[model samples]
Target: MGSLEEDELVRMVRDFIESESPSPTNSSSSNCLALSHRTQYLILQDVLTGETSSEAKVLKHVLKHMKGRRDTKRSTSLRNWLVKNLKIDGLRASLCQTSWSTSLGCPAGEYEFIEVINEGENGRTERLIVDIDFRSQFELARPTQYYREMIDSVPVIFVGNEDRLCKIISLLCTAAKQSLKQKGLHVPPWRTTSYMQSKWLSGSRKELENPRNDYTGSAEIGNWVPPMVKPRKMDLPSASSALSCQFSNMSLNCCNV
Candidate 1:
């Protein structure tokens, strides 16, 4: 099994490179193919996260393939080939909202924001429920893969200025560049932005603005809303008294009798 796996891996790499465009047919609309050692490292970072396999193991394989080359100045021609550019609106509410990346040992959820707190000098915190989408039971281990990790042993508590009090999780904005360097590939500094925009900062200013509701310059600070639950219908039980009755004849007051 191990030998077969190794052979399969080698063949795949060989085919991946051969498929690249070897020669250009036109200057304006050129059909060309090219890539570098560093590009593989960058892809490995994204693939490792989405997959369940160990990142180190996958990284090792990618590095092994990128070696034996003194490649330089990766062509930005691939930049024009990007298809289906997607930019998410952070302002929009998601069915599932998450504070920390699930793999980083944080809550897994699509929970509604209970409230956004802003603490100016002290910091920020977000108070939310583990399973408050509709009912508590719905947020169990099935969808979120919730474990003891979800509950958070230490409640991330903070009490200070209400200006920057909302919970904000910072993420790797340039993690890919570092990942490439670790695997022995050096890309130019300018190419950093082209590789990938940090996912966290892609949202708009209002969406990214200190999750804190505090706005020293604007009136929106006071306009912050409190949770408002919608009204629901309920069934009323019919009047029935087997033990005691208002009627004198039917009344059976066994205890008081």
Candidate 2:
């Protein structure tokens, strides 16, 4: 993301964080939380906009294949296809299944997403989380207009490092709590920040190995037809530009939930 676009998103999230709460007695606590959130948001922006990051390259290919696939297919099937195709393209990608036991009032659950491992400079390794349905993970049953717009601005396909994903989960979970409180509804345990963090952070990750001859009988293998006639490299900018436009006009609007 560009600096201008990043700043705009940060500002919008800040406004929501600093907005008045239903309980004025917790104003001090809310201020502290807002400060922490702002710090994490800035760190996340830095991680996302790193010029030397290999995530962009992997993400570009992911988006290309995703755009070329049938939308009716389930995410699991899409993820499997992506893992196979990415490996064929010489990228180390795999299906990551994360399962965690219930803790601190959060229920036990398992989540599956794609992950790409890249060997960075200086023998460093980077893990990128590629979530196809990222935005829906933060969705609420009923939300204020501002909250709805904020969540809607999140990219449908999220490609970021673990740190970036953690910060995003934290920020969104906090916002979810605020939105539910504003609606005079109870914040479910599943919506807690800890639960959200466990989904991607604190879990046993089992990477599914790519099978040999997996693509032999698949009709979708090695024959992706893009929806439009465009250069593979050029697709990234178009996708980012569309999301940037959405973030540009994002603003906090008061509404009864």
Candidate 1, residue 193: the lDDT equals 31
- Candidate with top TM-score is 2
lDDT of 2 at 249: 51
TM-score computed on alpha carbons, candidate 2? 0.66
Which lDDT tens digits does candidate 2 get at residues 129-173? 888888889899998775676676677788877655655665567
Error of 2 at 175 (Å): 0.7
lDDT of 1 by residue, 1-257 (tens): 49986576555444433343312111111111122323332222222233222223322332332233223211111111110010111111112122322322222222222122222234533221111111121112222111222222212221111111111110111332333455566644322331111111122112222232222332312565689999898865446552234554444555457
lDDT of each: 0.25, 0.68
- In terms of lDDT, the best-performing candidate is 2
What's the TM-score of every candidate structure? 0.15, 0.66
Clashing pairs in 2: none
Sliding window of 10 residues with minimal summed lDDT for model 1: 78-87
Clashes of 1: 15
